[model samples]
Target chain A: MNLLFILNKPPYSSDIGKESLDMALAHATFDDTVSLLFTGQGVWQLKTDQFAKLAGLKEFTRLYTGLDLYDIDQLFVSENALDTEQLTRDQLMVEASVLNDEAISRLINQQDRVFCL
Target chain B: MTTRFSILVTGSPFTSQAHHSAQCFVDALYSKGHQVTSVFLYGDGSYVANQLMHPANDESHPHQHWRELAQKHGFKLQACVSAAAKRGILSREDSELSGKSSFNVTSPYEIAGLGAWVEAVANSDKSLHFS
Candidate 1:
């Protein structure tokens, strides 16, 4: 099944963000088509040069590098959210397709299953 | 084909309306002859499984409602064990293992691993999350 995971939380601040990543990886491991969309504060999860280790938190953003190995390459980030946070593509750790509101809506509508976390 | 659903709750019971929203969604699904295969509670959402919860007579008890639903519909209601443990919501076995005097969770609301949540997602036709 095609699964779209919409993440809306910042990394390290809460376990939900990491758990959502785990969920996506698990689905992809089983050969399911998995996509991840970062919106709202979730855009912070992909920030470049994170030092969560200094804060005594698990560095889950490092796992994004391995997402491609798990066949979870459909990464998307909301353009509006990035703009709201004054972030740009160069600041992100991984390559993600920047999506506008309309594109995001279409992508969500095309999904067989959508999970917002 | 029967529309099989897997509900995921990631919000705390008292702090957020996610549990109530999940309950209403499940009720709607049942009324429409749909099946809810499982309800996976993660993060603070594990608090919903606390058997010690006792709300006032005027307030709606989401945990009690979930317990009743699990009993009536025979759907699996599981909370993430690690999350629950971190938040002090323990099952009988977990409580004993952790050397605790009492447990705050009971039957029909099992404390499980993330594998169980993944299994619920895999087995269902659709997965819905509330937070």
Candidate 2:
């Protein structure tokens, strides 16, 4: 259905972000032509070296690594969001396609279905 | 072109960039000749429709602005009933029961559930959320 899942929250704080990712993975595994966009606080969910032990939660970053394995590879990150949050590419685990506001506006228009979490 | 789209506002009006982002999204969509099928207010986004919001004269009135623009543009405004009730956004009946002078939720918008949101998704050609 050319679905695009946009995640706007960090992992472990709430189950919404993980549920969104799981939705994308499940849909992609079924060949739904899904894509993922990380915006705002959601960018932090892609950070590397995440250890959830201190937070009393399971490390879910590993789920992101399997995105490619399930063919949901069109991962995008808002350039403005990253810059505003002072995050560099090295701070993230996934290699994402950087997008500015104009780019994000355009990308959103291109999708058939967009689920923002 | 009768293109249909959905907007999900999940953040509070003043606390985050979601307000600006949502305004931009709605403006952009209509400017491009598309129609917003539904403006679904979820989570903190429900505050946007709070009827009691009255800012001072010098400041911009966000809630009023949204209501006017939405009504003028023929956009459907739907807030999650559960969210609104929890936040003290009473319906007409609730307002009467609580003895409020006027109902804040006076526009064409209605209070609905997630199933209604899924309905908007199903009816529209596209869905976009701002938070």
Best by DockQ, which number?
Answer: 1
Q: What is the lDDT of residue A59 in candidate 2?
A: 82
Number of the top TM-score candidate:
1
How far residue A6's Cα lies from its native spot in candidate 1, in Å, is: 1.7
Q: Over the stretch B10-56, how does candidate 2's per-residue lDDT look in tens digits?
A: 77888877767877778778888888878888777887788778888
Model 2: per-residue Cα lDDT at residue B60: 69
**C-alpha local distance difference test of each model:** 0.90, 0.78
Q: Residue B17 lDDT in model 1?
A: 92
Model 1 regions more than 4 Å off: B97-101
DockQ-derived CAPRI band for the predicted complex in model 1? medium
Output the lDDT of residue B13, model 2. Answer: 84
Model 1, A17-68: lDDT tens digits are 9878877887888788999999999999999989998999979789997787
